[model samples]
Target: MDCDSKTFTYIWEVNLDEFDRVSNLYSPPFSSWNGSVEEPWQLQFYPHGKMSIASSCLALFIVHRKLHHVEMDYTLMLINQKDENETLSVDKHSTFENSEDGFGPGPCIDDDRLDSPPSEGIYDPDRGFLVDGKIKIGVRIPTDPIPIKRKVDNMVSFTWDLSLDRYKAVPNEEDLLSPKFQTINNGEKNTWQIQVYPNGVVPELEGFLSLFLVHRGKDAITTQFEISLVNQDPTKSYRYTMEDTFSHDLNGWGEREVIGRRYLTNNTGFVFGDNVRFEVRIPLDDVSINKLEKEQAIVPFVWEVPLADMTSPTGEYLLSPKFMTWNSDESDTWQIQLFPNGIKSEKKQFVAAYLVHRGVKKVDTSFSLFISNQNEENTETVTMENVKFKYDLHGWGANAMVKRSDLEDPEKGFLFDGKKIKIGVQLATDHIPLKKTDSVMVPYTWEVKVEDLKLGTGKYLLSPNITTWNGQNKETWQVQLYPNGLSTEDNKQVSLFIAHRGDNEVTSRWSVSVVNKDPKKTESRTGTNLFGYDLQGWGSRTFIQGSKLRDESEGFIFDGKVKIGVELPSDNITLSIDNECPVIKEAPACEKCPAVVDSPVTKATPAGNPYDSPRPSPAGNPYGSPRPSPAPINASLHNLYRELKLKTPDGSEFSINHIMSFESIEKLISNLMRLSGSSSNYQPSISSYKHID
Candidate 1:
């Protein structure tokens, strides 16, 4: 194929200040040609670098947005604004299939080089790539498209014969292993084997024959192949065809019941002189092995709270600084709330910790929390997998993170230098969704016209409901206008409120205006609030003076008609989670524990809202107080027990004498299994057994 030798250049003027503020910046789409076809392409620039290179270098990628596949040679350059001859550049060749596939010229420049002074580097305020708070980036791409590389198929086949009498002589529950064989797939040599069970391995399929093809390669492989039980007559063979990927965790795939043993033994045509043949055919063209890709591991966020902070005479809970799950704009922010003296029933006996969502939208996440130890190997951890956090259900936690007595024990190492405690949380980064780059704000305005204003009967007038989109959710809102001030306002001023008609919580910036004959004289009150079930609406009680609004000379009641307008930023408004009341409940006491008093321990209450007030005695349950509900299962203990099952080979049950960590349980089980001479594959079908007094 002839290459299109023409070269095209594209220039992007980047503002350093804006680049520093955003994680990624994109250039306008440009056109490129693959052979005779033209396709659209764009550039993606990462300010703090991408993935593992973050904060260390600047990265750039060529993105192809069209379906056309293209291969081209390109050069990325960072122009030195002061001296054009000193530009830094790198050349690369890549193949892009679609928008999801992109290639970069590695790290275009080091961060230090871009931030140093002119004497040390080229990126200085007076003389380098970044001059006047801006830099120039350019890319040159050759229109010539490289020919696609083709791979040849290495088709290979293997056949083996088994003695039917020998298979029948073996135990029905035992698997007969075949000798290892070798084959070539896509230019790579691989080993394989076959396993046959005359009678099914599982108890559920006792009279059936099972067959499996196992790959013995060191790496995971994907292949398309066919396996067959050759019959006396060629066309009558039983064939199984499939395409699958096999990894170390699951190295084999086949049918549990390939054929009924009774049928096979009874049929004369199936076996030749007490021998059966099995054949495997694989076309290597479609076979491929998994290749390792560059990835950034999720680093856990750690917070250290002073021991004094938790045990202060003033009972104030500790709140961690807000943090993002990932180093990207789309990442959600989260916070940790720690109650030194646990709330409700566990109060004074345990330490409680909760994970709070501080983001604008809902997110599905799996996360783990850990309490650090002086020796890292002894740290304690609890995990919550596949949980959703939204506006209403914004926080989740364990009421009994650790017993107060155990935490205060000096030898536990939970308290560092007996001064502070370290806590860490790691979020499953893959589960977080990428937020949209462009956020558009839509405005909702409602105008209520009142004729014969003074003749209005009710204390407040309601406007028709308007439906609009708030971020990704739809919400309905209405305007409440009081012609005469609320009774609490002594009827001296008019009142206006923006009521959320929907059931869900919504955050918005709103304004209520009393329209006048002239726009300049319009009187308006503006405020921002999170409207939800706890607080349905928010507004100003003293919106406007009643006399001024009623006077014709004031131009407020023009032509005997009053106009009231309510404006709400409909879209792009952040939906904040409400933290008015703690969303935790008292847990039931363990039946074996001794009875404890329900009266709260006396402590200095921080002078704040009623929500933070000390818990009252059980006998004095006041009205409007948070109701007592069942608390969540102890995550740390549940996680440890869930992975263990203790049952002997003879079906006898066993139980641990005391509570232990998952590692301890695993080690004990391993030793037990070893001493019992049990098969590694033996999985006991019994509940997690524990004996705690």
Candidate 2:
């Protein structure tokens, strides 16, 4: 009826036979009938429930059992004004004719009423029942007889009442019972439309038709499908059978959208507890009828976590042990502390000793700490924050602990006194480990408290340049030369030598001397003009000159071409050469000076040391070649000027005398005999005047 698509609603029933020679007939329109007794054919005109007395009692009980062999019994009815709700009723409103006096066809019939007479006035209304009002006996029924009725024109209908609106269920076939389903944690899907609807529409079914999904209750779950066909007719070829038979053809559900994934567990839940109930079992080997002929049923989706909130499971967030350190201070090294109401692990009780000596112990100790919230005017010496701790001492003794591997070189002074007690000692072996030594403007004696002597006394200066250089020593240039006084109120610390005979980058360009001695001309600016030697090339900007006693400031610290020298000075000794070149003085030990060649407590005259014989052979071996007139031996000379003791731009006192002179040996033989002319008019004049004698 209009279950929406086509037409296939049916229900039929038939049962009735009681003599009249219809002989156990209940169909084929009463398989022949008859009533005997010489044509006593008025079975009282039966038409009780109509249909022409149910086809005239199926034609007079098949002509009274084919002329009285006596076996008539019948029942038949039909209705089809397009299935007029399929109405057919029989039970006891029927027809039968058996005769031989067991006369059985009652109701609207030939009843030999052994106490029955409900209707006998049809006048002549029944040859048996009817013969032509057209409702012959075609049995079709079902229009609500309380066989549990609730509207049955059937193309789809079933209800045991669970009210519907589910989250999963629905799968069925044939007879169209289907409504069993599943999908909990998701599975066993398909059926948004496997539509085999000649009587269900959905692309309106055509060729094959086979659908199923059994397991009406207790846990049945099986589904394996892969068929696609959303539309139809592409030269049609639909096949499909899940778990077995080989069907699966599908042409249309292509551009993808029917949905289906399959595979279920927990046996598909219905019972096995947790209150499950998910059904769906379409296994006609999954499905066929040419894969649902013109296809349309699909269902598959999974992603569920709501079994009513299920409960319990989560994790992540760790951080253990990190870093730690400690050594003595008892209680197993103070266990681990950060203190001030947050870290502190407790257990330590006491330990703060120190004083281990391996030789001559004099580490000079002191300890008294305090930092309980220090706040000296918001103190800051460039973000000054100190409190680093890490002191480990384990010097077992016997001197293996010398530089025992730089015990954490903070320039070797190790300390930690924020305080919980730490008195000190292990340091001396030539100390040098006091860092940052407190400051408020400095009066450093290295920690001697009383609010640190209230600060202020810091001026410090001790710079004497040249830290080291020995490219083949050269007696480090006669062992001495001094002068490093440029401040600290000039306490004049002198021992200088920026000497250099060029090596190592040209002896770093030496020359720097001092001892200007002209203090208002008391005379002694000996050779080599008043100091100056600054020659820093390779890019300019550096110059100063007082003509050579050498103090050339490219920031003076060169050690080349030998200069700064001074080792004691009294009676008379001054040889200041700052470099105008030629000035190599050695004189000053007079009284005929020449016997002190090497002495530091003697032993250096070798090569036949007879006192190194020089003047001895110079007396008679005047012929030992080259002694033409030797007599001036110990001359005592002076006049080696080279001055400039400052003040001279009209401020008087800036002498520049003879500047250089050194000839003796009788004025070097009287200027070599007046250049060898002995001029009295050219020599021999004594002989030419012999007559006057």
Q: Judged by lDDT, which candidate is best? A: 1
Q: Runs in model 2 with CA error above 4 Å?
A: 1-489, 492-495, 501-505, 508-586, 590-666, 669-693
lDDT per residue (tens digit) for residues 243-292 in model 2 = 32212321112111111112111232211211112122232322232211
Q: Global lDDT for candidate 2?
A: 0.21
Which tens-of-lDDT digit does each residue in 208-314 have in candidate 1?
77777788866888776666666664533555555677786327766666666655542535576555677776665454422111122455778888877777322
Global Cα RMSD, each model: 35.4, 49.5
Model 1: runs farther than 4 Å from truth? 1-296, 312-316, 327-329, 428-693
To one decimal, what is the Cα RMSD in angstroms of model 1 from the true structure? 35.4
Quote model 1's TM-score.
0.24
